[model samples]
Target: MPMVDTGDVRLHVQRMGPRDGHPAVGTVLLVHGLLTDSLASYYFTVAPAFAAAGLDVVMYDLRGHGRSGRPPTGYTLDDAVDDLAALLDRLAVTGPVHLVGNSYGGTVAFGYAARHPERAASVSLIESEPATAAWAAKLDGILRRVQRELAYNETDALAWITVNRGHNTARLARGAARLARETTLVRDIPASSVLTEDGMRAVGCPVLGLYGGDSDLAALVPWLEASLPDCRTVVVPGHEHSVLVEAAGTVGGHVLALIEGSGGRGPGRVSIPGGGGGRASGAAGPAVR
Candidate 1:
């Protein structure tokens, strides 16, 4: 368990690579979403796959989540981006590298790429949209609802999910409830801004997007197509927002492909254990990653 001090806070960070000891071509940073999400989301799922594919993998618990120092404030998007920048700086991770983010993590990746295009080699977004006014407003509504539910009925909500939903669902609900009850996540996320159209257009790196066919965020894929200069997307069938969990192998395959392509390397020969070929047909062209 290593923690990197980013001046403002200390982030719980982990670095991993292939057990066979192949040299890593470039770095791949994994960022998770809001609420109950943590570095573990990627740590236990896709990080090892990237490592096995010969890329240095980095993942950190965001402020107010996991084992990271949880300051009461500084949970906004700008703060999140700054934290990433500082982490990279502290780790001496220069040059362009691939970024893989899930949900809100994806939004941070987009924002960071737009802010510092020179440092990003490529980006892979999972079930995420640009932080636009519309997204911010929509997120605000969702956060408010979560805040309301957590403020008054968190225990009941957890109990209800435990009985009605599966154990994983109950666990996630409990974690979300505890975080909501303890941290300023509910207050800070709603205050963050989604990137504008111009901001989205500013990201110059190639991007790979993975989304669930049935996810609410899938609607943002067309917007990504219209905005990013080079974007490839895949919509996995029979999945939803939890693509990272439901289809980790598929997501990991695409990500390894992205890293391999970005580094101008040959195909990475690793199989996603339970991952299917979750690629949607007619994905802008043949799968580049």
Candidate 2:
């Protein structure tokens, strides 16, 4: 738990690596989705691969999420991206970094890339979408569910766990309230700022659009590939929205291939979904879906 001062914002960020290492294969800045902040989104996965690959992995809670400061209530996709940009600037993190965003994180990533193409190495989107009326409605439902769960008092927190999002619920009650109060996703995603899928095309780096190959995978993938020239798709044969927590290593392989390049220069067909995939980095792929 470390805090970085960005003049106007005190970002609560987490880092895992040596102070000085390989100048970082480019920092992997992960943005979590609705109801989830840092750590909860990546604690068991991804971080290790980036660390093992000798890259700096950084994750921070957006303005009103996690432990970050929450002023009255102001959170928007544009503002979240700006905060991210500011944090990077303050840390002197240069060059485009591999940006991994899940759920709503993907929304901010798309916005940031739209505004600053020079700041991205690549983008890995999980169970995500460009905001549309349909998308907004979908999110509205999830937000309502989250709010409902958060209503549980300490006495019923654990009992409320089973119906919630996380793959694990040992800390469900407290985590739910944290998520409920961190309404950045609710406050920002509902706006039209997130409706610009065209923005994804402006990014100057590689793009990996992933889906939980289950019945829920929207036509968004084909639509994205059709719209964004640099974008590609990967559908985990069997998975769902919370795929990250379910299958970390499996997901990492596909991500490493696209963003960092799997670099899996070995024997045989190294076909890791996403045609633009790189050589396998020796790290096993995480479970998809």
Candidate 3:
């Protein structure tokens, strides 16, 4: 459970790969969604695939989520990206590194790429949308539904989870309840800055947009194609918003391809001369969820 000081808050970060101390072909940062989501989603899903494919893997629990420090405020999109910049600086992860984000995490990656194009090798969004007004509106709808259906109080949420979703989903539901009760996420997110169309267009790197064929966010593919000059879009049939969880293997293959295609080449990739089999250096603190 190593934490990195971002000047503003402490972030729980996990780096994984072979411990052989091999230099990685490139670096890939995995960003998870909001609420109950944490680095564990990626850690258990696509991360190991990237690691085995000879890329450095970095995953962190976003502020106010998981083991990261949760402040009373500063849950805005801009704030999240700034925290990412500071973490990268602290870790001395120079050059253009791949950013792979799921759900709201994709918005963070998009914001970061827009602000720091020079530092981004490529950006991948899984079941995510650009932080546009439309997306904000959609988010509002989802939140409204959540408020109406789910309990914000820990006790009630746990009770609902146990009765409805059983033990497995209850675990995640409990975490979500804790975050809702303890943090300002529900309030801060609505007030967070949204990315304008101009902002989305400003990102100067290749983009990969993956969405479920039936997902509410599926429209984002056409949007990306119309906006980004170098964007690739993929739609997984028979899936919905939970593509990252339901179809992780398919998603992992796409990510590995991206790393192989862009993460080991010229300026976009960071070459680590002979160090073992392209393993990223372990974080200073022990790896934790």
> Largest lDDT belongs to which candidate?
1
lDDT by residue (tens digit), candidate 3, 41-102: 88766777678777889999999888999887788787899999999999999989999999
Please give, for residues 211-284, the per-residue lDDT of candidate 1 as tens digits: 87777666666767777888877777667788787778777777777666643232333455654434433243
Instruction: Tell me how many residue pairs clash in candidate 2.
Output: 14
Q: Write the residue-wise lDDT of candidate 2 on 1-289 in tens digits.
A: 6888877678888887645545566678888875434555675566766666667888888776667776544466667778888999988888888888887787777667777888888888877765556777776776665556556554454344433444455553465466456545455555545445455567757777777666364356666666676776676655567667665656676776776564333322322233222322221123232
lDDT (CA) per prediction: 0.77, 0.65, 0.73
Which has the higher TM-score value, candidate number 1 or candidate number 3?
1
Cα-based TM-score, every candidate = 0.88, 0.78, 0.82
What TM-score would you give candidate 2 relative to the actual structure? 0.78
Q: Which candidate number would show the highest TM-score if scored against the true structure? A: 1
